[model samples]
Target: MYQLTFFLEEFLAQYWQKKPTIIKGGFKHFVDPISPDELAGLAMEEEVDSRYIAKKDDQWEVQHGPLTFDNTPEDNWSFIVQAANHWHEGAAQLVTPFRQLPGWLFDDLMISYSTPSGGVGPHIDQYDVFIVQGSGKRHWRVGEKRDDYEEEFRHSALRQIKGFEPIIDEVLETGDILYIPPGFPHDGYSVETSMSFSVGFRSPKKQELLSTFADFVISNDIGDVHYHNPLLSTRSCNGAISEQDYHDLETMMRSLLDNPHLLKQWMGEHLSQNRHELDIVPSDPEWSNEETYQCLMNGDSFNRISGLRAFYHDAQPEIIFINGGQYTLPDECADTAKQFCNEQVVTAKSLGNAIHHPAVLTLLTQLINLGYWYLVE
Candidate 1:
């Protein structure tokens, strides 16, 4: 297992979302969990979100995968595979150390393999990221957050800035980590044939939240109350919306936001969804509740599938969300639900007597059948 040499609390308090910093030798004597060849293989898959970027003749070119390296560029090219953790178990372990942050904020583990002088160009990301240097070395330049930086499209799909005065510039060796927060302009190029693993975290924007909440409301028929105004004064102009009319309409909309239960439900469903496709394969022959329970009691453990989002709010501990679906637990099984959400592996011993409860056993069976969790072989 990989471990960070730096103190997480000090890092979070001093540098998180405030500025960019390089933690030298973050993982002492680091060993790459996934190799360049394995990353390339993942990029070849249709379900994977990968990109090939190259610059030739001072012009940038971008290709969206599934890619083939039949006519590969000799240099000045990079191959990036997004959400590698969703499909690769070894790659998924890279995110375990960073679980100190909110799990819902995590986006994915994006792995990139770059040849000498290969880079995606200077760009700004709207999400936080920790770029962990693997084998070989990379030169990274990070600029402070600035709203005045102009964005230019080098390629149709690539948005890059012309250049920025770098605040933090260094060449990172193996095991070094660079932490960059959202809105920071940064660029990195491989000093040699190198692999970099980026663990990204992002929170929902207001627009996204509003749109998703609206959809949830429509789907569940939760906020169908029509606007009502009992006393309406005659208006001088029909086109003019009165102050009282605006107030009443605003209140009507605000009523939905005021409901704590509605907000919690929306948050649980929204945050539990994985932005990338999960590698889920349901059991061919579904295990019955009794069989699943018997297996668990017999020392079998269930491992949660990589990139499956599972979480429960502290305010509503009885309700847990998994992959956009919410399940309410029995009072006696609340701790079990919390364990399933917090831990990647579930064992009969870990669950204690909760595994014996018929309701809990049934839920576990259902989840396993749905492919969210699988028996460890």
Candidate 2:
């Protein structure tokens, strides 16, 4: 088991969201969690989401590869493989160290390789990412993510930066990690054959925010938010809209968006909950004291995913929340679970030792059977 160092805890507590950080050689016994071959295999599967982008001479180019790279040429190119960790358990372990951060805060794991002079060009991302340098060296130039749009060689759909000034410009080596916050512009190209692991977190898009807020509004069934203003008679010089009415419309829209309750739901769904939870469906539902007893007799362990997101309510730190549901545990169990929630993995024995309670054991059993909990035999 990897022990949480004082520095890791301190960094997360202080600069995680407030600022950026770069931790050199943070992982030891270090291995490339998954290789390019494995990523290619997963890409071949139709159900998976994968994409690749390349940087060539004075141009940023992209090619969609679902296993074959026939479209790609041989020189001065970078190859990006995305979400490798999502499909492969081995790759997922590399992410285990960052479990202290909430799962919702994570967007995806992207792996990339840049041959000499290959890079993504200078660009900014509107998200937070930890760029873990795996093998070889890469020179990085980063700047603050700006709102201005810069037209370049990019997908027509994407809004990207034109250019920016560097705030942190340096070369990254094996095991080194560079942290970039949202709105910060950064670019990296290879000094050699370099590999990088990017763990990202993103704010929900407008569509996502609006749709979720609408649901929140609906959930508040008793609220009097119905739009009801008597229509005025047509009395206009140009039959055009008046500034006051326009302002009123804008105000109403803002009011709906500004509602505290609505904001909370948006946060809960996209940030507080796990992205993987939507894909999960508990297997066995029927449980009894007898069944629980049998599991104990057989020494059967609970099933838990190493990536499961567990946390306590920010305000009510007493209430434990996981997979979009809330449950309260005994004081000891709550504290213990909180520790496990923020950790990569924990055993049933460890859990039992932490919180000696039948109910807690039962919950673990349910989670295990549901495949949300994992137990080592």
Candidate 3:
């Protein structure tokens, strides 16, 4: 199990999104949950998002996967697979220590296996990442924050920046962690053959918000109110939109913002949605309400699929949004709903009256059958 050497509150207030900080031996005596061979096996799978990057004498190349290492040389290359937690139960355990943060803000776990002198080159990521060294050693150099750096792309899959000066340069051993915030140029190369696990957080861009909101508006049948002006005054310039017109337009736009209920629903649905594909398979035989309730009473537990996004809003207290779907709870089952949203593991004991609530039972049964939530065997 990974252990934190420093306090989370202090780390969040001091360094999160503001600067880079390295915690030596963050997971003291850390034993990697997944091995390099396991990671390489995942890279060959069709559904997994994997990449292979190689650098040879200043020339860099990148290849997208599902890939195999049969034809490629072993040295001077790195193999990366994204959302390992979603597919492997062992990889999912790595996420246990970081649950103190908001559940919805989590993106996924990305693991990389690198050979000697292997790296992806200097690049800037727009999301926060906690890069944990799993095995062997890696030398990391993190540069200062700069948005205007020119990018050089040798291949369509790779975009790299030139000449990054280090703000933090160190060799990280097994269990060491390096935290880098958004827009900070950073690069990591294997001092030896190494494995690194990255726990990343979501930072949605403005364009993404606008695009997803447009979809939400169309789907929900909201924001359809046409602008109507009851008071029309004579204007000197017909082409000009006067201050009143601007104000009216702004108010019309703000209608989406002003509707708290609608905004909450949209956010709940949007935030819970996953950007990557999930390795979910519906149960061949669906669980019935009676079967689910009986299992709950029999002391059977439930585990949420790792990397599953779940959230609730204060404005929509009874609704638990998860995996792009909304599950409404009874007033009596609100506490239970919070547990389901906040926890990766769920027990029958913590459910209280939710187990007996007919609507909640039905919803749980459906989710279990759909494989979003599974019965612990």
Q: Which candidate is the best by lDDT?
A: 1
lDDT (CA) per prediction: 0.92, 0.65, 0.86
RMSD of candidate 3 to the truth, in angstroms, is 1.6
Clashes (backbone N, CA, C under 3 Å), per candidate, total: 0, 9, 0
lDDT of 1: 0.92
- Candidate 3 lDDT, 227-274, residue by residue in tens: 899899888799998998999999988878788777778888899999
Better of 1 and 3 by lDDT: 1
Cα displacement (angstroms), candidate 1, residue 271, comes to 0.3
Q: Is candidate 2 or candidate 3 better by TM-score?
A: 3
* Local accuracy of candidate 1 as per-residue lDDT tens digits, 197-304: 999999789999999999998999987777777776777698988778898889889988999998998899899999999999998899999889888878989999
As for candidate 2, its clashing pairs are: 143-185, 145-183, 145-184, 303-368, 303-373, 303-374, 304-372, 304-373, 304-374
**Candidate 3: residue 53 Cα off by (Å):** 0.9
Model 3 CA lDDT for position 374: 86
RMSD of each: 1.1, 5.5, 1.6
lDDT of 2 at 208: 77
Q: Can you tell me which runs of candidate 1 are displaced by over 4 Å?
A: none
